[model samples]
Target: MTHRPRSSARRGDHSHGDVHLHGHGHAHGHDHPGHSHPTGVRGVLHGIFVPHSHDAADSIDDAMEAHSQGIRAVKVSLVLMLVTTVVQAVIVAFSGSVALLADTVHNLSDALTAVPLWIAFVLSRRVATRRYTYGFNRAEDLAGLFIVLMIALSAVVAAVEAIDRMVSPRPMENIGWVIAAGVVGFLGNEAVAVYRIRVGRRIGSAALVADGIHARTDGFTSLAVVAGGIGVLLGFPLADPIVGLLISAMIAVLLVGTVRSVGRRLMDGVEPELVDRAERALGEVIGIDSVDRVRMRWIGHRLHGDALVRTSATTLVDADRLASTAEETVRQRLPNLDEIAVRVVAVGS
Candidate 1:
């Protein structure tokens, strides 16, 4: 006998020796093994410098709720980044600091990146249609590609401006205001980074996580603007353009990781660890003989997959029960799991 279970509901149908089950229920547990924060001094440093991708403190089990949270995070971060960019722009005009100008340009791009992400999150909520069976979830990945282009464009613009300033060697004015603007930029970008990364990890949104990492890099580059201002204060006029060039270089280097991450999703590549976890969950089910195969992918921030399991259950009733248990086990193991199809086949058949 073979059994296939459906998601979003639980009912059973029997025909011949085959069984089909479907229905919906809530999962109460949120225990994810090997996804805990580090301890000791390393933990503190990691917390300060590198944010974890998963945090149990705010994990949302509901898909719709996760989408709502993602939109809210984008909205708030967008406002903060816009304010920071405006403040930096005013300072750049008064101080003529190429470094500040570079940072401001990148920040503006970062803020605008939120618009597409917000649209994506909203589009992901639509029901699947006949023409687009997977719904609009892939819009999120497309938004990620747009973000990559924006980052690249900002890098090119910054590099060109820095080179021009280096050639002309203009004397920077109001060094103190430039330093103050740098401080403002760092604070704003860092705050947005922390918020976006936290929410992105909580919801498993790779696009949002990439944006957050971008913001974090921008924060560090803003500090470089401060360094340039101090150098100018000490009478090194070339330092401003030099720091601008370095910022452009940093952005170009950082673009590689974001591209790889978004590309992996577009190619349907998932972390091996997620597959391993699904397999383990299936194997642990009471009536399952073995986990034959597991395949998973990210659609927007949610996980959806299918698995094949072998079972000794020879009758339709036993197979249906086994399939339901196996599916539930996998769901409990993985947070933000939107859907999973479990197929059970009789062993030695």
Candidate 2:
């Protein structure tokens, strides 16, 4: 049922060290022939220090490490947002500031959003089994969808609260407390935003990055609350609701970008720049005549690629050299490149 390459049929005689490669099947101890692999002490040292490994156990270790880093970011942000919400809730009780209440509610919801991502990261660490060959990596993306939904829901809640305040204006108490709470909200959200965005980008997680953006938006909304308080001080009774409405509008606008970003990842879209980088790396290999195709995608924060390369090499040995070289080149050039499948085709074939 499977078609074998003509070159593979002739590769039955090919051997790497003492292991012979069977016809039409490339299965071997090593990923490629003539590839110099770490042995004994060097392999152990590389595994301990570098953390990246070609072995299954080592790969799982790396995956766990990546997930732990993401979880740390979420935990820290969750704590900060919770503290901010609690402080604002206390101020709301004394101030009766509808604008402050709306922001506080949004902050609470934002803090809860981290829970799903935390669980997703945990689920993503599960080992691949027969039923789920790709493992649970896509759990992160699904969690991202949930985050986007939560953000949209927050926008709607903010809108409804704003509209209600506009229709029936109420006297807000402890205006100074409302101002102080706004400043506190802004500081907390901003700090979490900076940390989340930095960690998210480092781990290459679209979900985490979107959550970071959401936190940044929350920071701006907190600023809007401050502006509303100032407007009330300036004798504009409707300013509180108006600013809340503006905050909702800003969130709605940002939702579109997050949707597009998360949707692309769910659909297996890889950045063009990453593909270009792969192609360039493959092209640099001495025996590779041309890079025919390069396809890459992310599974969680890890990257995998498949490339077809045309080689000018006249013999099987030269072709093996091309394949090995291309693998090494991409591994060196790309960050978090988990694995790559390179197909070697003879020139003009």
Candidate 3:
């Protein structure tokens, strides 16, 4: 019979013969799980008028803050898109521009895209219950799925409108109004696109970033509308429907990219650089034998990870300290880390 050596440090109670390390005095409760700014003039203005911008270079401290940033971006973008759509709709009625009508519909869809994401972020704040041990972080990913679907639907609608216009050519009226409305759509969508993408990257939200890309596609289509209006002014009557078809084709291409991105996130894909960062941070810790494995994934904009490490056979107390230090190192190096589990393995069994 073979016997494994147990040090005096391991004499005390243990679970599965592995030391699980956690930071001392660390709070286990959800941070910013259900937080909101006080309702008043400030909150309303912040929610509507002021654009909330975030920098990708900055580190996010907690999950609640991350979710708030995403919500803020979505809210502001939604408002801007709604206003753009209203203006375009008015023009569409007067000018009878099929291209402008399609752009307006797409812009309205983009505005509504914020709703699912907002709900997802809000749901993410719900405390973990018995039925949901992981909390509601996955809601964000689910919302991402909705965003992809909306993008697909918009493409289909645009294509159909374009095809209908092509089959029965109608004289487009009020070319000036169409051009102005197209300009307005371009500006609105472009602003939302930049804002959403910046905040999304800052908060580590793949879904928000995907939506931002979606808005950027709309902006380009709006520009195409402008081109079509010019073509009409130059006496090319087919220009309106032709540009609409081009816009539809471009949207289809974007849908492919959006699917891959959202699908990857849903499948628990993460950037390789984060794994490298974890290994590097663990390696730099004192008394670590080797970092065997590091796995990380995004739950909403929050990051969670598990790491396995090997260390020299030592007192259980020392092993615990080594593990704790590793956890701290990782927390300091990585942004938006909600929780990290470190398992310590003794060297040579």
Candidate 1 similarity to native, TM-score: 0.83
lDDT per residue as tens, model 2, 1-349: 1233322121122212211111111211111101122446544432322233232212221445668888999999999999999999998888787767877887898899999999988887776677876678789999889988877876787788789989988876677888899899989988887787667766677798778777877787677778888999999978988998987886776677678778988999876766776788778878777877887777776666677777666666666655666666776556555556677776677
Scored by TM-score, the top model is 1
User: Which window of 10 residues has the lowest lDDT sum in candidate 1?
Assistant: 10-19
Clash totals in order: 7, 0, 1
Q: 155, model 2: CA deviation in Å?
A: 1.9
Better candidate number, 2 or 3, judged by lDDT: 3
Over 133-206, each residue of candidate 1 has an lDDT whose tens digit, in order, gives: 77788999998888777767767876887799899977776778878988998899999988988888788787
The list of candidate 1 runs beyond 4 A from truth reads 1-50, 53-57, 89-106
TM-scores of the candidates are: 0.83, 0.79, 0.81
- Candidate 3 segments exceeding 4 Å error: 1-54, 92-106
On lDDT, the candidate that comes out on top is 1
Query: Which residue pairs show collisions in model 3?
Result: 9-316
lDDT of 1: 0.73
Quantify all predictions' global Cα lDDT against the true fold: 0.73, 0.70, 0.71
Candidate 2 lDDT trough over 10 residues, lowest sum: 26-35
- Which prediction has more favorable lDDT, 1 or 2? 1
